[model samples]
Target: MASLPPSDEATLTHVQSVLQTRTLSSPIYAFILTPLRITHASRGLIIARLVLAAPHLNASGSLHGGVSATLVDWAGGCAISTWDLRTGTGVSVDINISYLGGAKLGEEIEIEGRADKVGGSLAFTSVGIWKVEDGGRGSAVAVGRHTKFVRGSASKKVEDAVKTAE
Candidate 1:
């Protein structure tokens, strides 16, 4: 196989879009894709920022672990999911999380995550959920770590074609 091409989320979305419409027959995606947009995207790293209202807040008037888990899953997945665009396959194997402070309700929480390391068939990612003020220092309320299973062959077809044309 040739060297692998660099990857990104737009790249993955584009690649997955067709398959999503065809093979990915999930009705749940309709709701997840609408209203809540994927604010940030990139290869290697990704961050998703969400503004919480009443419904998203927890019973004790704080962010919920389930919500936090959603952030962990998405961020971590994005951290490594870009691989499928370049090599074409993978999934999450294990995910771990630690709660720090209680994220207050009504505060906008931003979930940020990046690949800590990438080895042969595994990707280690770290995620952080924080309360960020418009122009002030933010508080990290939760953190998560994930191990993603990676697969498939590396190829430089796209980059190679572009390079050859250039």
Candidate 2:
């Protein structure tokens, strides 16, 4: 299996620590029940695990569509962060989700996010959520694409300065 380099691993660890210790600023994440266990992290990619629970379910006792969208938003940001290890991942410009299947309570799901392109002013990402069965990834729960406006992010500014200097 592919693994994160030491530096990226440290970044992932720090992010996980922040999630565990801090009261999440995003109310949606708190409502969804936070602290997603990051299974893997590397440049432009992140994989995390979340267990479906009461808050994550709809009245019919399946994973909520809103929750799936929220995961797309959240995971996309994490993938963007991997580009430069920036805490601020930027603001969502657009998000599109396709509900492919359902996951039940007590079921574990894996969310994979990929930063398809990270430019100075914008970042594009895709997220896939799947139910885990028999210790492997099972049916797809949802797939989404997220776009973010990242102009003036700290890392971008620094990079811009370096380019100017060069």
Candidate 3:
């Protein structure tokens, strides 16, 4: 029920509308075949929803490890963006994921990302993917840790200065 910045809200609305209209032609998201919806957004926390489907499953009919990894990566980045840190340019420097359990197709999963620490030039984040039960509680399926190198504030300042001089 939290809110995001105006700019981020616009971005979120666009992404949601794209998925809702089934007009998302991006290869990666299309291949996953899951509609990701932002449920919560704040300074250091973000929550999203993903309903698994055939394409997200493996031969054994559970969620694929690679797909989980990708979710972690994407969710972590989304969470970090909520902070609006340093002109909002951050790139993943390192990521680690652990598969804890299996999520069957048709299950609704909750993906949460938290910013553990945000420094001037680097940021640390953690992500968890969980299977949501009837009561809305979730069981952990995967957990991830991520590190990002942020580079935008200084560059933006320089660019602004140059533009002003012109």
Candidate 4:
């Protein structure tokens, strides 16, 4: 397995711990997708880093399209979470991704997400997946945009109704 650098060890450990617990609540994220470290986080922006692994590869041995899409979606959520918007409760209304290149296994990649706009009922976010280079000026592998609808009282009522029905 590819290992993080000494400087990133602590971050890796924390990411593992969070994934382990999140696995109980969100199995797909922990088991199927590779774990990632949040390198930077602030209001409206979040940056994540990961080393591509076997599970993230396609038949051609490059990063899979689906995996890239998932990362973009997750990154957007992370960006929104940085701002603590909508209590971090929102549903993706639409997501579009454009794949430009691919990263090989064991290669490190950076995912940067930015919340472009956050409205009362809607939020718009963009994400860029980059293949990290020597100078850390990585080339873009993919770019994506996501639109989310902030959960409101109507969403709560729907959840309540579902629970009552169940």
Candidate 5:
């Protein structure tokens, strides 16, 4: 994962609040409060309910594949962290992305991700991306799955507690 800047870490609380309003923040039982904002957050979750901004645009005017990939990775990472086995910290072991279509500049693309399973030292997550206007149109622009190794920063048992509490 790319090291997030300070701005990203500072926005975590706000992002968590936003995720709370929409059912988008929680991927299963893991809370995705923020990506960059959470800094060293154990886990995070978010929804792509709208199109990206101009800064994230490509020359073709459509969203760039890099941007899409980054989005998937970010969401996928959050899913893994939320259900992290040992600590909130985890590292990606694998991420495979398949692109099928293009997204218009202003199209609201909805992306969702969650852990398929969290193991003793690894977590598996999958993210689905598609246009939101018609629910699901054309083919999927991209689909990605991330495998990560869990750390002991926060204790794997905490994840279990959170799950049980939910």
Candidate 6:
């Protein structure tokens, strides 16, 4: 497992607290994805864990495709936010996903988001949804790449988190 340096972790924590208080925050996350716990965060990465439940199932009782895509979108933004503590990560330009497996109710799965590149006008991110089997071996449930247009999205208040952490 990768870990963030203390300063970066402090920044992440500060940003997360601000995000949680906003009434206009992620509706999908507030509705169905609450209790989602971030296990680790680094400069360009985020790792989280959640248990599959009634709200996250498909007709066949496996993790829903839409849910998987939502995770990709949400996690991708989170990874981007870690890049420079941007509060508004950006708007999605494209999202591509490959379904590799399925997870059932009561199962715990991990979602990992990585910011491949963050540039002046665009940001690229990849996310992997993994289900762990016995002995702690993880297999991919889905993988996705996300591209977002991020020009002029940085906010001074959010950037202050980094300065305060430092």
Identify the candidate with maximal lDDT: 2
Candidate 4: which pairs clash?
none
Deviating ranges (above 4 Å) for candidate 4: 1-23, 32-34, 85-89, 153-166
Q: Model 5 off-target regions past 4 Å?
A: 1-47, 84-89, 135-139, 154-166
lDDT of each: 0.59, 0.80, 0.69, 0.70, 0.56, 0.79
Provide the TM-score for each candidate, comma-separated. 0.65, 0.84, 0.74, 0.75, 0.60, 0.85
RMSD to native, candidate 2 = 5.1
| Tens-digit per-residue lDDT, 95-120, candidate 5 | 88888777775666667665677777
* Model 1 TM-score on a 0 to 1 scale: 0.65
Q: Candidate 2: deviation at residue 101, Å?
A: 0.3
Q: Is 1 or 3 the stronger prediction by lDDT?
A: 3
What residue runs in model 2 are displaced by over 4 Å at the alpha carbon? 1-7, 17-23, 154-166
The sequence of per-residue lDDT tens digits that candidate 1 reaches over residues 1-166 is: 1233344556546334422442344343332322243445556555556666655667898877776776686666555644333433236788888888776755666676677776677778888887767743287789998887764442222354447779
- Residue 69 shift from truth in candidate 3, angstroms: 0.7
How do the residues 44-132 of candidate 4 rate in per-residue lDDT, one tens digit apiece? 67677888999989999998998898888777765665444222425789999999998999998988877888777887899999998
Relative to the true structure, candidate 6 reaches a TM of 0.85
RMSD of 3: 5.9
lDDT of 3 by residue, 11-77 (tens): 4543344344332555676666356777766666677788898889989999999888877766665
Q: 1-166 in candidate 6: lDDT tens per residue? A: 4544443666568546534743247677675567677777778887778888888999999999999998898889888888877777778999999999999999988988889999988999999999967735388899999998888844334756557889
| lDDT tens digits, residue span 1-166, model 2 | 3444543666676456435433257677777747468887777888889998888999999999999998898889778877776656778999999999999999999998889999888899999999999987899999999999887752443245447779
Q: In model 2, where is the ten-residue run with the lowest total lDDT?
A: 153-162
Candidate of highest TM-score = 6
Cα shift from native, residue 79, model 2 (Å): 0.2
Residue 83 in model 4: shift from native, Å? 1.7
RMSD values for the candidates in order, in angstroms, are 7.6, 5.1, 5.9, 7.8, 11.0, 3.6
